[model samples]
Target chain A: MSRAYNFCAGPATLPEQVLLQARDEMLDWRGTGMSVMEMSHRSDEFVEIAETAEQDVRDLAGISDDYAVLFMQGGASSQFATVPLNLLGNSASADYVNTGIWSEKAIAEARRYGDVNVVASSAGCGFTTVPDQTGWKTRADAAYLHYTPNETIGGLEFDFVPDSGKVPLVADMSSSMLSCPVDVSKFGLIYAGAQKNIGPSGLVVVIVRKDLLGKAHVKIPTMMNYQVMADNASMFNTPATYSWYLTGLVFKWLKDQGGVSAIGELNARKAKKLYHFIDTNPLYSNPIDPRFRSRMNVPFILADEALNSAFLKGADERQLLNLKGHRSVGGMRASIYNAMPEAGVDALIFYMAEFAKERG
Target chain B: MSRAYNFCAGPATLPEQVLLQARDEMLDWRGTGMSVMEMSHRSDEFVEIAETAEQDVRDLAGISDDYAVLFMQGGASSQFATVPLNLLGNSASADYVNTGIWSEKAIAEARRYGDVNVVASSAGCGFTTVPDQTGWKTRADAAYLHYTPNETIGGLEFDFVPDSGKVPLVADMSSSMLSCPVDVSKFGLIYAGAQKNIGPSGLVVVIVRKDLLGKAHVKIPTMMNYQVMADNASMFNTPATYSWYLTGLVFKWLKDQGGVSAIGELNARKAKKLYHFIDTNPLYSNPIDPRFRSRMNVPFILADEALNSAFLKGADERQLLNLKGHRSVGGMRASIYNAMPEAGVDALIFYMAEFAKERG
Candidate 1:
């Protein structure tokens, strides 16, 4: 089977091996006489699948006893509303760090629930850099400080985690989750939509410090209540089972590849190879601050705007697909996610150099 | 190529042909070089998939121009909250007819959003029959009247649609949708969890009248807002693409085997065959009132409850699995959904007779 290297921001590429395994097990799963999708969530067969998926996540993320990991639906967007509903408690305010489009969206949703304090913003800098943490104006009694670690749209990332002292810190790690090692204990909550580096689009993984549970406002629906979800193992309602199963397979594949540490090295190499080419080549330019350039999503503009279509068309001919940047950013983005092999990046770099030489 | 007859309640059986087609197109969907799961929701490929899926649903359900069909997540349970949130509007209350576990759950969730008047209830009769609509004490100005047409757990079904007049009728058809033909014009809204008769667990099909849009309370999250989902074509967030794709295939298969009108006849025949066997056999009994018996889920008890273990074991040995009744109602329930062939029911009847004879 010929598979092109996919570079879409999300609903993105998945490990080819996981797809093959899924296909092989599509009819019957381990003598259970049913596919994972066909198994009832309450069935012992599916209970094991859910449990193993959670266990793999815990192992990979090094989550401690203080954190509860939940596999939920409605994507990260759902979490935008859910986070505030669960965390705000009696407090009517929270701090938001605006790094890019995603954080802005999160802040917008949070405002409906409470008073949002824009602690620091990179918007004034064209969202190309992470604002200095010292510039944040956080309320001492705010519910929590929320930020997005990597913004898929702007290809901006935070090189370091922010400190919130006693106050809880919540991060939307949708685009950068599992791409590198993370200290699970540092944040009060961390949530990521699975489309980028986990497995599928429909499932969202949330890790919340245990003490934060059971504080959702009384008006919160059962499905949106973190405490209820944690109590029921995220099965308070029917979960996105097939997506969860695919996530489990991807987790297993990650472990077999020596966990996040090993994958992180390979990812660093891939990003460096591409970023280095763009930096030196006159034909290409990436505007994001060097410190905050996302390793997963690399957005670059061609020197001549007219050549943009030609670049994408030529790339498509060579079997490189979904390289167009997000419409908000309007350029080209090469999302070298975990599923993307280093060879894919090398091929892209080779093509870029050839294009530059021919154009010059 | 071996496949078991899956008897799961939700996340249940799918058309074998649909699964086969999904498997065939798993890697490269229609030369897009991407799995349906990998395609961008905005891409022309997925847009076509989404449009065709909606059109197929419209065709199968005979939906008129006045109705809008939405593909949503969170299952029927989410709709419990969303229904009232969207329709309750400026009204402080709505009327709910409680028939079984599902309707009770709906009422409980609706209570969180608004005052729910229990217009009628079958719990008084142990959920064996639907309450007479004539006796319903519905509010004079209820925003809407909600009921479950078929309760999968209780094995009770409403033989006739309730006349709500201008109050607008909403039905949870999760267990009975498309099992038969109905006048779509009678109800303001209808929603079905796809697992039972539609496709899979994660996708819910919501059919709402065009007039019901934009009435949601101000604080309702954008994802749960019916109007937002309708406007976005259910792509407000990443949907369950695989489940949606399978549902589209099922719609095509249904069209091939004649529309809902023809399928309804086959379903009625299947239910009659099983019910006749139970009514005549001395050892088998179904407690549901005959008029309210469900054609989709038939729950029967062995006269000698001790033989329950033996009955289930025998059925499993014959590859008739998941015949064990719901825990709340301890008896055998054979969910003969749309995908269960007549031969499967025949096999079930033959086994039931043999088991009864041996026990006697």
Candidate 2:
């Protein structure tokens, strides 16, 4: 089977090895006579699968004992509302750092539950960079500070973690988690939708400090309540088992490649190679601030707007797919997630250079 | 590959054909060069898949243009809150018929949003039968009447659809959808969790009257808003694409086998064969009211409680898996969904008679 390099920001490309493993095990998982999707969530077979997936995620993230890993549904967008519903217990407010579309969405959802302080915003600069955190006007008694580590749409990323002082830091690492190494003890909670770096679209991985459990407002739905999910080990309902299983396979693949640090080095190299081509080539340009360009999603615009379609057409002809940028930020984006090999990056760079030379 | 008969109530048994097809297409679907799970939801490929799935469901259910079909996530449990949040509008109350565990849970969640009128309740009868609709205490101004057509745990199903005149009728048909033929226009809305009969656990199908759109309370999350989902054709967020695809295949299979009418006949025959064995056998009995016995889920008990373990063990030895009943009512439950062939029912009946005769 010929598979293209899928650069879609999410429901993005997964490790080919993981796909092959899933295909092999689709009918029977490890002699369990049933497909993972058919196994009861409560059964020993599924329980082990779920546990191993959670454990592997924890290992990859270097999650500490203080943090509880949750496998949840409804994607990261649901968590935009659930995070506030669970974290902002009695407090009437929270601080938000608006870096791009995703961060702005988090702030808007949080406003439904409490007062939101726009502690830092790059909106004034067209979401090209992360605003200076020192300028943030944080509330003294705010429940927590929320931010998106990588803005998938704008292709902007935070180069460093923000210091929240006494306030708990919550990061929506949907597009960036597992692409690099992170200090687990530094944040109160980190959540990522598994589509990009982890596995599939339906499952979300959440790591929250244990102390934050059981503090959700009574109004939170049982499924959205963190403590209940934590107590039940993310089996409060039948999870997306197939996605979780795929995630487990992806996690195993990550370990085989020498864990997160090793993958991080490779991801950085892939990002640098692609960025260097875009920088040297006059026919294409990436507008994000140099210090904050995302390693995962790289959005670029054509020198000639009319050539945008031709560029995408030429790329598609070469089997480089999903490079069209988000409609909200129209241009082009090549998301190079962990599953994307350096070879795929090199192929993309070669294609870009060839396309530029022909156009020039 | 050897496969076992999985008896999970939800995330339960799937047609072997679907699994085989899914495995074959795991890498490339119809030469698309990408798995259904990896395709962008907005891409023409996925859009075609989603549309075909919806069209097949409509054909299977005989749904008309007046009805809107929506595929959503978070299972039917999320809809417990979303249904009330959407339909309640300016109305201060809604009517809920409490038949068993699922309905009771739905009532509890709905109570958080508006006053819930317990129109009828079978809890007094230990949830073994549907409460008489004539005795219902529905409010005159209730925005809608909600009911679960089949209770998976209690193995009780409504014998007749309740007549609500102008009051919009909403039914959670999670366990019984596509198992029988029903007049689609008779009810204002119908929702089902896919695991049991549709496909897998993550996808929830909702059919609503067009007039019900846009009434969602301002506070409801966009993911939960029926209007938003309907407007976007259930692509408001990244959907459970693989599950949706599987459900589409299941729908095609059902259509090929002469749609719901033929399946319903088979389902009835299966239920009768199993129930007749329990009724006539001195060593086994089913306590649910015969009038309300579910054609999908058949729960029974061993007359000699001590032999329950032996019964389950023998069934396991014979490969009659998942025959063990729900935890709340522990004895045995044989869920005969659309996929369970008549031969499976015959095998189950033969085993039950053989085990009963030997034990007696």
Instruction: Write one digit per residue (lDDT tens) for candidate 1, span B202-310.
Output: 7889999999999999999878999999888888777767678878888988888798999999999999999999999999999999998999999999888999998
Most accurate candidate by lDDT: 1
TM-score of each: 0.98, 0.98
User: What residue pairs are clashing in model 2?
Assistant: none
Could you tell me how far off, in angstroms, the CA of residue A41 lies in candidate 2 after the best superposition?
Answer: 0.6
Best by TM-score: 1
Candidate 2 structure lDDT:
0.87
Model 2: per-residue Cα lDDT over B275-332, one tens digit each: 9888988888888999999998888888888998888888777767788888877988
Q: What ranges in model 1 sit over 4 Å off?
A: none
Docking class of 1: medium
Each prediction's whole-model lDDT (CA): 0.88, 0.87
Give the C-alpha miss distance for residue A107 in model 2, angstroms: 1.6
lDDT of 2 at B219: 77
CAPRI band for model 2: medium
Every model's DockQ, to 2 decimals?
0.62, 0.66
Backbone clashes, candidate 1 = 0
